[model samples]
Target: MPIHYSIEIADAAAHLFAIELTIDTPDPKGQILELPVWIPGSYLIREFARNIVQIAAFSKQKTIPIEKLSKSSWRIAPTTGPLTIRYEVYAFDLSVRGAYLDQTRAFFNGTSVFLAAKGFETLPCSVQIKADSFSAMSKQWQVATGLCAAAVNDNGFGHYTAQNYDELIDCPVEISDFSKIEFEACGVPHQMVISGRHHADMERLAHDLRLICEYQIRLFGEPAPFNRYVFMTMAVGDGYGGLEHRNSTALICKRTDLPEIGSEQQSDGYRQFLGLCSHEYFHSWNVKRIKPAAYAPYDLQQENYSRLLWAFEGITSYYDDLSLLRCGLITFEQYLHLLAQTATAVERGYGRKRQSLEESSFDTWVKYYRQDENTPNEVVSYYTKGALVALCLDLHIRAETQNQKSLDDVMRALWNQFGRHFDTLGQGIKEHEWETIAQAVTGLDLTAFFDMALRSTTDLPLSNLLEKIGVQSQLRLASNPTDKGGWQDNPVPSACTWGVRTADDPQGVKLTHVLRHGAACAAGLAAGDVVIAINGLKASASQFASLASNAKSGQCYQVHAFRRDELMQFELVARDAIADTWGFCKSKDSCQVNKEMLATFLRN
Candidate 1:
């Protein structure tokens, strides 16, 4: 007999909604029920089960009391025959990861559903959802799941079955006014269901997505791994982000984020939106399938630590925008400009001060996702610097092998060894396993690269890497005044600076490390010194830039500062700003090397 489960969503009132689940099964001794501690793609340990308010269970019309087994699992007493279980999940928050209920709508992630069975953890189960009639106002309520035998009902409910927990967690369902657009990319059926107020040029978006898929396939020299793909978008107000999955992705974005075609400024926004799309799309290979061992069989209850996020997220980030360029969606200049912006942002943050890339990856839960004012001063972004690291490593590989091998080789080797070969039973790729793969692919030791580049804060030779790819990394000083009227400066010499990087704390303008003898440092200021005033005016992070803009070379003024809780004053002198620092250079040789390495790398 088929194991059966059902869900019903009822509109109780505005600011409140009700969800009910019913399940039927015969065996109880071997049954195990659990709620996922975290969702994939988003690497944080959030106990979603804590949100459950009231629960009840019944067997053969007799009431059964449920017992808590663990933080995320529960147990039901032994039953003689077929058992029926029911419960209600609370929905009160409106965030992307949480369940939210309101007068207008209700959103939930599947882990909220309670299960009861004998060895339920191992038993194959089926779910049938019963939607309220009012749900018809949504136009259509669709389910995005990996479960088998799924069907939709006229009452707005859908039915699906999961072979196991892995399949169950992979699927996410949405009930709303969703527009479903289907097309084929690289011979794979691709579907996009956009909900919540999507007003962009759907046709153009669809065409662009098709091209993106084709480009990715060409990169790997094969069709995508999934037979079908889904892009499910949840639109709220002003939010923008997404999480990737094996066969589908969930996107949370603002309706206004979609840009109109044929408009100049809107084109930039469109490119950004597409960049997000490409980022998640590339995950189909780089992350979703070819995952690090730590993430292979994810532990939802706590952090899954890995140092290779730079490889997973950073490399994917580099390609997200590059995919746009390769598909002729963006210009080379635009690509470089985007890189420059990313580089400058990476150079300005204080996060780099407290965390290295590997540490940043390992501590993403505490540092990256949870950001504060000191973030700029204390934490480095794995996404930004991680991409740069990928570029550096790719160039290093190319330069060492005379353009015969590159980072792409590492990616394909991963796909072949871990992704294609591994089954659900073998879910992760170990750290040393990646090292072994890299050594085999490149015929060289990657220990130094992993140690120095991935683990250590050794300055990346970005210019050399860019030059190898026929791109110049240009770093120019700002001679022009910023809107705030400060001589835009970086804290490091030959570094790009915007004059002020501030923390939200009232530690009162501590001069965090002035870039190796920058304007602030050259004027005899050291890091850890708090600026009390700029040119005799009380200053904040925002105000310092304005003061710097109005000043000229050889301008001297009394600068008050506090260091180690002691107030001190110094005479500061400003110097004329330098215009450009040639950061990277590339010739025909480097370009050819880059192309050849890329080709070989993708070919495995």
Candidate 2:
């Protein structure tokens, strides 16, 4: 008597697709069919269900007319017993979270699929997907889901059963010759399936991932809640993101981003890949388990608002690289470098001047996902500021308790208190609940910390906190090499200094801005100027970087630029670069304190 549904898809064209659904129910009387308005991980994404077209209903293998029940709901006429519902979804967009259908292949997120039973949210359900027969695919084309039982077939169909709607939504299926690597961590089976051309050291990747898993488990003082863990990496031609689930994570990254074993040790591409891994891994604890109260019982129809996204995403960001350090995947110096980079990015963002972390977290739907030119001016990223806020809070806790407790203690306490009880309640901890837990763990009132750091634009006391850990963060005016009108800090020969903020723009080598007092600025230039030629040779940003990679400081050159609809010429004098002049620091004292704090933080 369990609810069951099956889908049959027809690959009609390269950019067109069709799917039919058959559903079985005990009583179809007064039954209502509904499509989820939005999917988790992606907030404010509405109209996803509207892509479903040409919907038809059938009963006993006979065609029946379906009645429009509501905006996102439909009803079958004279629903007396079981019925079969069929629909066509337009899958033209090749996005990870949306349905994509083309001559090449097709992909789908369960939110695009509608469930005919409205009140049966808690009921058990099963799904069967009919694949394309032309492709010589096997059952090895794995199906990933939190669903209890799944069955595969040779006729291009995969069958899966879920305990409820939540379970169904968490499973994402990809059909391809995915590169899968399996290992064990903390006595649990771990699998990483990467689709696309992965050109990395597989053995090293698996080994490092295992260490990360083991470290996370030990930090929690218990094994992961799930018996199996899967990392579904979708390496498309050009994609960049990931979404976390209970037992799996859906990642969309560029195929070229998978670094080879001996690629540049400090390449941006490699750093980004590491950051992505850390981000998703941290989510296993933060977003998947220690969730926001609003997300506990998710309402797929609308935005689930919470003022604690800083804790969810920002705190997760703080821990991502720290987890890397804990697992020995990155050294303490490397970890500091990453933090310094994040600090520089946050400081450069003008949006931080306008938006508070709490406001940014609440308005994630309207701001973060839908970024535009004004975004840099109006919205601050909760991820950036939230991480800083977490850093500040961790330092505050450590300082107050004489390095006896830190943010790790707060996370463990949350896990012990709410994470252990989430299964029974089916929701996440409330915002206020965090305050109570913080107090319980730190024995200190966090009202000021939350109000100023999280809810307001109070500048973080990063210097004092970092000093306790033996690091120093200071900001000083330096030469701006990219700027046309700024002073350039010239260094002696044999030393190197390159200062320029370059990005790919339709216009040639677009110089976004010249650093104040930088070589380019001191030579006479301004922001919005495009560098057409360097040293009498036409070049782009990439080409210029390649040429300058070997150039030494105190180098002189003739630079040509287009400024304000006019061609201009200037002489440039290169300067010594101060790379770490933008953010707060941690001195030797602070480093020692932090090391001690880390020990205590991880101990209990």
Candidate 3:
């Protein structure tokens, strides 16, 4: 029998959702019900079942014996036949990974709200949504989701069907008086639904979004894959995140990031929001459809590791911004600045010296998601470095083939090889398959490049690789430093550049971090130390920041701070900034062919 489910806001004030699971046929031994311990997209295993409360099983108004087998699984003794399980979930977690509810709105992911029947997982399931009856505000709420329509109406409220339980949860439902606008890309209908009480410029959003969507579709040589797609965004006071699904994505952004009415100028916040949108949208192809070997069949009971996140997340990240540039959402200068910013961020981090991209991908469950104070000192980011790997590969292919083939060709080849055939094969790309395909597509043997990038913690040769893309580079300080011994003996007591980050508290300026080799560490100032004064002067948060950049070079200062309420002082010398300069310009000697290749890359 079909596995059927229904979800409703039982109590909006308490943020509780009532869920009912019905199975028309029960296993002769017993009926097993389990909620997922985690969701895809986010690597961390968040115990989603812990939120379920007050569960009961009934076969025909007769109580069936219930037994808890594990953290996420339950079993029911055999009864008359069709078994029904009713439960209430306390859905207050506001992030995109789980369920959330309030008088203002309601949102829930399938893993957070649906209970899967063990034997019927592969069978079709249906979700029936009920209107909120918990509060006056919920009365006016509407619904938006990506689930295929079985009995749902135009307002997106009612029954939705999925091919299986996996597909059921892949589409999250949002209910509120959100602003939803429909647009078409490559003859496919797409919806952008924003949930919040805000004045967003939907016209501009749909216009720019169409361009990005069309560019991506054209890039992979597919008119469209899904019947319909959705962008379910929650605009909040301050937040940023997204989780991708098969046909939709759930996103959260600061309310100010949305386009305001009558504003033609795109703010940095709006650009960042657009980038977020593009990032998640690109996942529809990269991570969602093009399955990684480790993630081809996710084991939601525990952590799943893979060394191809760089290929999945990194490549998508590389293309997200590039797609924007290709679509003319931003200028060529803006794209260069974005590239430089990414390079600067990756190079300055000391962790890149300790970990390789493959290691970073494998250890994400332990290191990337769960970070410590020493994270910057030990861990490298697969996303940033991986994007560089993609960038390097792009230039290598272009330079090798003399601009005849680019990374765009590599992606299309991958799509044809893995993505388009993912459903039937269910086998993701293997680790070695990357080089094999790159060689087959670009005719370039990249053994040395891939070895240096994935196997060792060596810095990417950006200066060398960028030359292929017609961009010249130089190593210089991101910021200049004052010459030593250039200050007077009593140099008006100015501040100088120091490498300490601080925040404000009632007592004084609290040290947030002391860079590994910075003056603060040299002076023994710990992370929690509050600086009450520096050199017998008041050290307020603002005052300390002013002095940090303006202070004299090589000057020793009598710094006084509270180390856990104990007064202490140290003689700290001024140091320069610990940041890297990432500026790229067109190579002076770049031939016309190389220049045209660069133009084709950025302007395509």
Candidate 4:
């Protein structure tokens, strides 16, 4: 028996969605229903059921007794006939993971709205959307999703079919008067949809995405998996996020992240946005189809733990920016700058010394999502470090095989073995099998490598691996590597560094964050302290920033700051600026080896 859901944009002013669920065959011993605690891709357990403002059940115009079994579950008292469950869900989360509804637009992930009939998950499901109220405002409003439309109108109003509950939830829907365009990648049609205001270069986006998508398709072989793909985005004031699906992805970015119709320069924000796209799109092959064993059949009710998120998300992270370089969306120098920034991030964060990628992947629920000022001091990001690990492995594999093989070969091997055959096998490689599989593919023994990279917190052997690739890495001084300006200036010796990150405040300079183990942290300056003076003279954050930029190494100065209405004074030594920036250059001797290896690494 099929479960059909009818949804309406009811009460858009109040941000409410009314949904009616019909179950044809209910369990004789009471039917169980539950909303997932979290969505895949996003590790946090966002209590989606909390958004249910009201619920009721009915049968033949009579009220049916519904018992609340848990926070997100309910049981319908044994009913011999068909049942109808009607509920209202409040949708206001602005990110890509949940749901949102306003006069301007309506977006929702099915996990936040659809309730699963526990025992009937394997049955087909149908979704019917009624958005009359939304259309009354503007006829241009349309729905965009990767879901299969069974019976629908030109504007995307109608019934959509899914093989099962999982397929239904995997396709998030966006309804708005959005700017949408279509293009083809490797013979597969694709759609790009965006909400919010902007004069985006639609053709430019299509051209770049065409290159990215086509390259990925050819990377694993011809004939892409999905017949169609969709990119649902919401451009906002200043936001960024992405959640991947089987055939589509939901993204959120700042308005400025989109390239202006005539602008030629690609801002860092724009590049980051593109990286988010590549990251999520890559998952179409890595996570969505490749199937992590633990995620093969996700237990949506609880956490499905896996150690290979480093492989899933981490490798994707590594390739996200690398894809840009490979596809010619950005230059090689820019790629190195991005890589250096990631290195600086992992190195500066004191947590890498304390946490391993395996631990970071597992503790995401407790630590990564819920972060504080101490996060940098205590937690290492699996996404960032995992990318580093992937790069290290790529370099190692290339060197061991004498530039004949690279990480690209390893990924294709995995895709062919696991992702390509997911439908037949319904499961994936076990946690303990990756090393053996990698050995078989690359013919290299990676025992010591995996141990240090995943099992222990030892720093990666970056210099040695790059040397084999015919590139050199060196720590240098000057403007911050992540400052978005290309490495155009020479390193100067007089550059001064501070241990504190400051922001301007009405009262004075506010220490928004103080890096641990730096001069500021050692001198007792903490986050949230307002610095009113330097050497007893008034200074704003900007003023102090200028003074510190030209500061000489190893100097002492009096600091005056206030901690919650208590003024204090402390003497601190000016340490040399942290030499964390790494500059990558082609070894003058092996320009040919560098060219060959780099070409092999970038090729599909």
Candidate 5:
């Protein structure tokens, strides 16, 4: 018999979910059950079993003995008939990676609520969502998920079926009095459900999203992968995140990020939100289907390591913003501004000179996810640098073949060869096999390029490659701490540097980081130091930028700070700012050939 589960709100006010699991044909050798330590798409091992507050087992209405095998596994004694287990999970997490519940709404990922029954994981399963268990005042709430509805009420609270345990947990469930808008893209139904208080223009959201979705669908050719898709969002005062699923995605964003009624101009926050959506949607084929060997069959109990995250995540990052430009959602000048900002961010960090992209991808579990104050000095991000690598590859292919082939061709080949047959073949790209595949697709031997881009710590040659696409690259020192690099005809330079980032504090200003080879490091100033006075005057976070910009070079100042409640004093000398900021602009002298290549690159 198939496995079955039923879930309901045990205590809405207390933030608990009651879940019951039943197996009709239990394994005679003591059935085993386990909860996943981490969810896919997120590399961290969160140990979700720690949230189970209470549990028990029964057989034929008789109490059955249960023994703990490990932190996430349990074994029930052999029984003559059907076996059942009931438990209460404390769901208090408010992020996109776990379960959350309260009077406002309820959300959960099956990895945090359902337990996988050993020896029967491949069997089909059914889940019953008891929406009636919610408080009387919340009876109007509706359920939204990617699961196939087997038998459900008008409110979408009833039975759902899954092909196997993997598909069961891949879709997240969101229940609330949400505002929903539905639209069609490429002959497939799509819906976005939002939960929170906001005065958003739902029509504008649907129009812009339809453009992005249709562009991506047409990019990989027709016949979309999924029949339908859902965008489950939770808007709060301030937040930002997204996790991709096979046919849906869970998102969290600041309420202000939503587009306001009667507002036509796009804000930076809104652009960022759109980029997040594009990034996750592209994963529908790049990661969720065309996956790395290590992730083909995820080992949820422990860490899964792969060095090709640069291709999976970084390539997706590169296309997220580019797709926006191609879809006419943003202007060409604004796209260049975004590119310059990314370049400045990657160049400003000193860590890129120390860690290779492969190492960063391999150590994501320990370093990337769990960052520290010294993260900038030791580790680099595979996401930012990986985008640059993809950019270089695309440019190189276009210049070498005179715009005859590009990364777009390579992606289409990947989809046709691997992604189209993933469900049946269940095969993944090997660890060191990407270079070979790219070469075969483009007919170019990229051994030297791959070695420098993936195995070395040196920065990629971006200036030359950008020129081939009719773009000019410029690098200069930041005008101030808040100067995010972009194209400027006449830019003012800062007088000096403090080499420290400060936040508002009750005392005065709290140092958040001390950059290497900066004035703060030279003066022995470290993170967590609260600066009360500078040059015998009061120091504040509001005025710190002006003081740093106007201070004369080679000037000495007396700094007084408190390190963990101890008063201290030091002499700091103002130093010149480092020239690491980047700016990009259209080249006036670009020939017709270069302009044509640029148009070809950005065309939908």
Candidate 6:
């Protein structure tokens, strides 16, 4: 018999969800049920069980003893008949990874509420949502999710079914007075369910998303894996994140980042939103189905380590914005602008020289998720550097094979071998298997390239590879902190820099990061120091930049800062900013072969 669940918004105003789980054939001995401590896609142990405000078990309407075995597990004494586990979850986390509820809306991931009956996780399951629990707003509220509807009402209140616990939790549920826009890609129905407030141009969004979806679909070839897909989003004043699922993804973004109605020009924020959408959608094939061996059977209780996240996340990152250019949503110049910014971001970080991509992937739990002020100096992002690695690999394959086979071929081969039959075969790519697959697909041995990119901290040969495709590249000094790399004609550098980032503080200018070997580091200034004065002149966040800019080349400035209630004084000498920003442009010395290759690389 199928395990069943029914969840109701117990108190919308208090952000409570009351759920009941029924097991028809629970183990005769003590049965243990567990709530996953973490959710997949996002590499963080969130300890979802802490949100359980209250819980109890019963058999035949009589309260039964339930022993708390661990933080997230419970053992119910032997029950004669069917067992029922009831719990109330406090769901106020507003991000896509957790649960949230208010009078305005309610959202939840299965990991936050559903309990998996040990040894029976592979059994079929069903869930019923009590959408009418909120009498005042029940009429307008509707449900949106990827779960197969078993007996849902017109407003999407009722029952949903899943083949197993994994399938059930992989799909998140969103209920609110949301605006939905429907579109189709490759004959598969797709919908975007948006919560919160926004004046988004639905038609334009549908048009652009359709193009992106079609391109990605065609990339992996005909029969798409999912029958339908959903983009469930919550818009706020300022937010940005997304977590992928099999047939849908939950997203949060600033309302202003959405395309405005009747606006013809694309804003940078809107482009970023579109890029985020592309990134998660691409995961439907890459990370969602294309499994890393460590993730194939995810141990939701603890950390799952892999040395190949660079391949999954990095390759997806490389393709996210590139899809915008290939789909005609952005121009070639705009694409180059985005690429240069990514390269510059990696170049500016001192940690890239200290941490290898493999180490970064392995330590994602401790380093990537729990970042502090010294993050830039101690850690390298697998997303950015990994994308650069993917870029190098792509160019290398193209160059060696004379454009006969590309990274596209390698992805297709992975899909056919590992991802396509994943549901049935339950297999994943081994740690070193990607190299083997790439070699087989392109008929090129890339062991040296992989070793250098993953195991060593050596910078990628990006400029050289980009030049072969007729794109001239150069590194330049940034004029300001907000200056991300792009083509600039005779860009002027800042007069001087402290090599530190700062934010406005009520008391003074708060230092955020002190780059290694910078003036701040030399002067013994650390992150979290609040600078009160510079050369005896009162320093504020606004005035700090101008004061640093006006410093003489050889003059030292007296700096007064507060380091945790202790006033410290130091002498600082400003120096020229580093040339770490990258700029790119079409090469004037392009030959016919180079032009052909460039055309193929950026093919629409």
Each prediction's Cα RMSD?
Answer: 5.5, 6.0, 4.2, 2.0, 1.3, 1.1
TM of each candidate vs. truth: 0.81, 0.81, 0.93, 0.95, 0.98, 0.98
Worst 10 residues of 5 by lDDT: 131-140
| Comparing 1 and 6 on lDDT, the stronger one | 6
Error of 3 at 248 (Å): 0.8
- Tens-digit lDDT track for model 6 on 240-339? 9999999999999999999999899999999999999999999999988898999988889899999888999999999999899999999888988999
Q: Which should have the higher lDDT, number 4 or number 6? A: 6
Better of 2 and 5 by lDDT: 5
Find the candidate with the highest TM-score and give its number. Answer: 6
User: Model 5: how large is the Cα RMSD against the reference?
Assistant: 1.3
For residues 116-192, what per-residue lDDT tens digits would candidate 2 score against the true structure?
Answer: 47777787778776654424334445444444556666423566777777777777665555677889998998878
Q: What TM-score should be assigned to candidate 6? A: 0.98
In the range 1-604, model 5's lDDT, one tens digit per residue, is: 3799999988888899999999998889899999999999888889999999888999989988889999999999998788999999999999999999999999999999999999888789999998578534386799999999999988899999998899999999999999999999999999998998887788998888898899999999888889999999999999999999999999999999999999998999899889989999999999899999998888888999999989998899899999899999998888888888888988888789889999999999999888877888778888888888999999999988889999999999989988988978888899887788889988998999999999998889999999998999988888767788898787665568888888999999999988888898899999999999998999898776677788888888899999998999988888888778889999999999889999998893
List the candidates ranked by lDDT, beginning with the highest: 6, 5, 4, 3, 2, 1
Flag clash pairs in model 4: none
Tens digits of per-residue lDDT for model 1, 1-604: 2466666554435332344433455445634556777777777777877766666667778987678889877777767666565556667655556565544445555654544343444566666655554354454555444345456665336667777656565666665656677889988988887777666667777888998888887676575777788787776677788777667777777777675546445365578878888999899888777888887666665678887787789999988887887787886667666766677667655456557888988888887887654466677888988888777777788778887787777777777777665555456677667667887899888798878766776766787666655665556654333211111234223322333344533744766556433466566676677887766787576666545566676777788888777888877776555543223323435555566654443333
Any runs in candidate 2 off by more than 4 Å, and if so which?
A: 15-18, 26-29, 69-71, 102-106, 114-116, 131-146, 153-157, 259-268, 476-595, 598-604
Residues 1-604, candidate 4: write the lDDT tens digits: 3699989876888999999999987898988999999999998888999999999998777888999999999998887678899999999999999999988999999999999998999889899987576687578899999999998889998889998999989999999999999999999999999999877888888888898898888888877878899999999998999999999999999988998898888998889988999999999998998867888899898988888888888899999998898888998778878887787778777899889898888788889988877888888998989998999999998878887777888888888888887866776878867778888889999999999999898988877887776767866664742352223347554566677777778989998778877878888989988888898789687777777776666677788989999998877667777666566766668767777887777664
Better of 2 and 6 by lDDT: 6
Candidate 5, position 177, lDDT: 90
Q: Considering TM-score, which of the candidate structures 2 and 3 is the better prediction for this target?
A: 3
Off-target runs (Cα >4 Å) in candidate 3 are 132-139, 478-497, 586-590
lDDT of 3 by residue, 284-332 (tens): 8888877677787777778888888888888888888888889999976
